[model samples]
Target: MTTGHPFMQAHPHQPLSIAAKILSPQMIQTIRKLPEFHLQAWKILDRWAFNSPEMLAQLEAQGEIVLMSRLLDQQAVEHQALMDSTHQLQNGMTEHEILEMCEIHTEL
Candidate 1:
């Protein structure tokens, strides 16, 4: 809400960044230091906010904060899946064997 925040340094005619208004200053700094993929995800969320102001406000009013931890949890799951597949391949498991282990049926 402070006009002196870095995110508020936008051109006089431009609106302040959504992250500045919604996220804590520490959160903004941390997000700025995150990887490109994470930054892209934030950009997507910001666009969603721009497109759905009323919904965002309603969620905020209800005390619903965005859960970046869920994203990290999902990333961990995906990374574990990839590591498992890589290990299987290294152990000479054929693609068919891996697919079968994963219960994914495919027509050869």
Candidate 2:
């Protein structure tokens, strides 16, 4: 925990209220589009005061952030794969087939 960190100066009782104000519109939009699991993880990260030593220690003990980050990374890889597949299919695949492929991908 750094004393000079922005979260250190954040209103301790407000959680994400101050943090949300600092996020760019594009960043917020990107977060909004995340899947429910990842969205929940982001919310947890957003709500924590990382600059407080006690909170930081507790967070490290919980290991939630590391798990969330790994999950998000895996999701990004899957999303990129799907996007690439969709682009390749756009050459000749029918709309119905594309939709079906997306549904199938999501099921996994």
TM-score of each: 0.33, 0.27
The TM-score leader among the candidates is 1
Error of 2 at 82 (Å): 0.6
RMSD to true structure for each model, in Å: 15.4, 16.0
Model 1 clashes, total count: 0
- Candidate 1's error at 16, in angstroms? 9.3
**How many clashes (backbone N, Cα, C below 3 Å) per candidate?**
0, 0
Q: How does residue 74 of candidate 2 score in lDDT? A: 44
lDDT of each: 0.45, 0.43
Model 1: how far residue 48 lies from native, Å = 3.5
Residues 20-79, model 2: lDDT tens digits: 454444444554565644532343335342434354334345564553464365455544
RMSD of 2: 16.0
Estimate, for each residue in 1-106, the C-alpha lDDT of model 1 and write its tens digit: 2233232133333222664566456655655666732533354335334555565445445542343443344334434454579987697665345445666422
